[model samples]
Target: MSTAVATATPTARPTSRRRRRIGSTEIVYLALVGILVVAGVLVAMGGGNLFSTANTAYMLTQTSLLGFVAIGQTFVILCRSLDLSVGYVVALCSIVGATTMAGDPSRVWLGVVAALAAAAGIGLVNGLVVTKLRVNAFIATLGVGLIVKGYLDTQFKGPAGDVPSSFQMFGYTRVGPVPISTIVMLVVAAVGIVLLTRTRQGYHMFAVGGNVDVARLSGIRADRTVIIAHVLCSTCAGIAGLLIAARFGTGNALVYSYGLDLDSIAAVVLGGTLLLGGRGSVAGTVGGVLILAVLDTVFNVLDVDPFFKDVLRGVVIIAAVALYARRQIDPASSRARFRSNRRRDPVRSGARPDPTTTDGGASA
Candidate 1:
């Protein structure tokens, strides 16, 4: 009777362990979502008028620029690459746009075209450096950023030109109470989501980011994917620059240079994308941008020191990275231990051990 009972429960151990793993994953996901909701509520309760139509519009408009850049950073970061050139790209594009369209509002589209081209060109250089020259993405993009900034300084000699009224209109205009910039952001975000979730290339991007060597062996053209990611990142940076210039009505080359990259990275990481790459969502990135915008508004309304805002941002980034690291580390460790134990167990090695087997099988 004892032997029969043991046989009947042979697979229970493995089954229970698998169940534990699924449960753990679910808990982590729920916890993250809950944190976001709670944070949002706290901000609202702390004098942030998140529900006011005007404030909502302002928030959306403000987030649009950073949100676009954050979306691009999401892809690049997921591919385990960093683009420090983002700020420089924004500076250069805004300079070019402002200078070219200074006198003629009708020619603003020309400036836009030129800015996009320049951005793509910068991206191409970055890709070539990383993929062909074997330079690390961090160093390559940082060097490119410095070079671009130098050129911008030489050309602009300090924010000399004003953005055309037409461009400013695009940045400041409202469409039935919705800011045009916000509308544009939503469209871009929607496009990004579609490209990431629906296209075959999107899957390839994810695979390459997840494991480059494996992706290369699987014939996924990882190099092309990296190049494409850089291009997209630069393009987003260009758009951000244009928006900022239009919003302020002047191309302030140095003012935005420092904060642009940091804000984009913060927003992307805060939105739930892994710093190490291969796991993130556009929706998360958007949420992250909104979170930052809300924080900025709340701090301003509450008359908090500007310095404290920076400190809070730093804390959030650290917390996010730590959480992601723990998740990655714990799961891998558990799986490794499970594999090692299985290897040492002769009975579990040969047959499909029953899930109920109680031969020291560890629970996840």
Candidate 2:
């Protein structure tokens, strides 16, 4: 028994270390921390004052806007769906909300309702098309986005209608140097974290994304999960549109400069959310959003060309996806690889393999 215990102790340490090393969330956390450090260094070298109160405020505000959209996208993607229509929904909602306000502070709530309703409606349509009609998500949302874009073009050629002062205040008001929008964003994210980490519905979403057949067999309503995710996604977009309109004090169908649709997806993906779904965290998504905002600010300060910024963004997205994919190793394959490597080690060459290693490694 003493010898058996001694043997087991050596095995446990390597197994624990191996598990820690391969853990997807752990890897993502480390990567995020490293990226933030690098970003800080770059910002400092670029002559950007990231630590200044004003710059910190600006960063949080910008991050807040993008963060909402990305938060929405995170849910949708976690359910193994995409929402290409979010950008157009943002544009359309901005127009509807702004136009409804028509400079009346009292009627701002009316615009808010209309905007959110429209966004939710769009989400429902996308969900129906994908789940009921058996349409591909990418195609369904893209078609919806195109329809929204066409409607936007016909409705207005440029910025139209005024945003109410009350709405503007909601967007711009600060609490001891922190923008109200940023505060709202933090609240939204906190709610999201709770929803995903602590709720039954959130678990079902992950189950559905992990495997639709398995989810159904387990009595989960896969389609309903998808629909709910899309609704939340579009609703978030609506909220973001409202904030954007308030920030600009006007409505423009072409308001988002970096293409909120793709940017949000990029942020979600960069934050360690699997594009294939079933994995991610709100905190990771927030980290990803901040990284992007930091890079955008630094590039602007360095006078980088707009075209180069686009290229760099594309490269970053691709790299992030690739790195994420690398960490998604199959347990069976990992165990097999470990055994094969063990066989090649000189000290372990003639040793009888521990039968428990495969199961333990795979579980890890």
Candidate 3:
């Protein structure tokens, strides 16, 4: 019994450690924290304050637009799909909102509704193409995006409709170090978190993404769930368009040139969501967005070229995805090995075989 107790001590410690192992989300945030520390030091060395009141507001403000799009991206990605059409949808929605508002404050809500409705409609089409017509999500969204872009190119040459000052408040208003846009973005993210963790639709999304055949066998409506996710994603992108219109005080036909579609996807991946799908969270996505915003802020402070910013972002995304993939693969392999070792050799796994059970001569 004493020998067994000693052996058990080693096994128990590993079990406890495994239970308390840091998850992908925690790792992401930890990386964010480390990045912030490094950024602060670098900025300070360059004769700037990273956490100044103005800079803090700027960072959060930067996060607002991307956060909205990334939050939306989180949903569809978790459902094993992507939306390349988001950039075009954003451009279309901005035009729709501004044109509908036509500079009337009373029309603000009207514009908002119009933009969201347009986005949801586009999302519906994308989903239908992918789920019903059996088009791959990537191709479906890209085709839709090209169609929307062609429409925009044929109709508009530059910024068109106007945004009212009242609506502009969303882009500029700040309370302390937090912008109202950031606050709104956070609220949307909270709703996403709830949808994922507390709602049936959310569970179905995970189940379907994890394995469509299994979900189907379990009586889940996989197509409906994917459609729902796409709708939610485009709606979020529409909200982001609204933010852009608010910030610029007009609808810019060329907003799609910002590469928001890829940026949002990168943010979603950086937040620890699997690229192929099935496991992730809104909170992690939010953290990922903040890291991008921080990098943006730091770049601006250092006067880096816009092209270089994109390059750096691409590198970061690649690195983050690689790291996250390793993290995902390693733990499962570790658990499998641990189980196999325990089954094959109990003593090696820190278990002492019972003498009475294994050998009658030893029992005597």
Give one digit per residue, the lDDT tens place, for model 1 in 148-187: 8887777767775677787898788988667888778888
The residue-by-residue lDDT of candidate 2 on 1-364, one tens digit each, is 2222222334332433334455545555677567667766877887776557776677788898899899999998999999998888888888888899999989988999999999999999999999999999999999988988888888789998789898899788998768999888889999999999899999998888889899999999999999999999999999998988898788878864448998999999888898888888888898888778767766765678999998998887788788777767667768878886875673676776665543333322
- For every candidate, C-alpha RMSD to the true structure in Å: 6.5, 7.3, 4.7
Indicate the worst ten consecutive residues by lDDT in candidate 1.
Answer: 1-10
lDDT of each: 0.78, 0.84, 0.91
Worst 10 residues of 3 by lDDT: 1-10
**Tens digits of lDDT, candidate 3, 1-364:** 2233222223333433446668778988999999999999999999999999999999998899889999999999998999999999999999999999999999999999999999999999999999999999999999999999999999988887889999999989899999999999999999999999999999998998899889999999999999999999999999999998998888888989988999899899999998678899999999999999999999998889999998998898899999887876798879887897787787777888764454332211
Better of 2 and 3 by TM-score: 3
Error of 2 at 142 (Å): 0.5
lDDT accuracy of residue 297 in candidate 2: 67
The regions of model 1 sitting more than 4 angstroms off are: 1-50, 331-346, 349-364
User: What is the TM-score (0 to 1) of candidate 2?
Assistant: 0.84
Counting clashing residue pairs in each candidate, in order, gives: 9, 0, 0
Badly placed stretches (over 4 Å) of model 3 are 1-19, 331-364
Name the candidate that leads on TM-score.
3
What residue runs in model 2 are displaced by over 4 Å at the alpha carbon?
1-19, 22-33, 46-48, 330-364
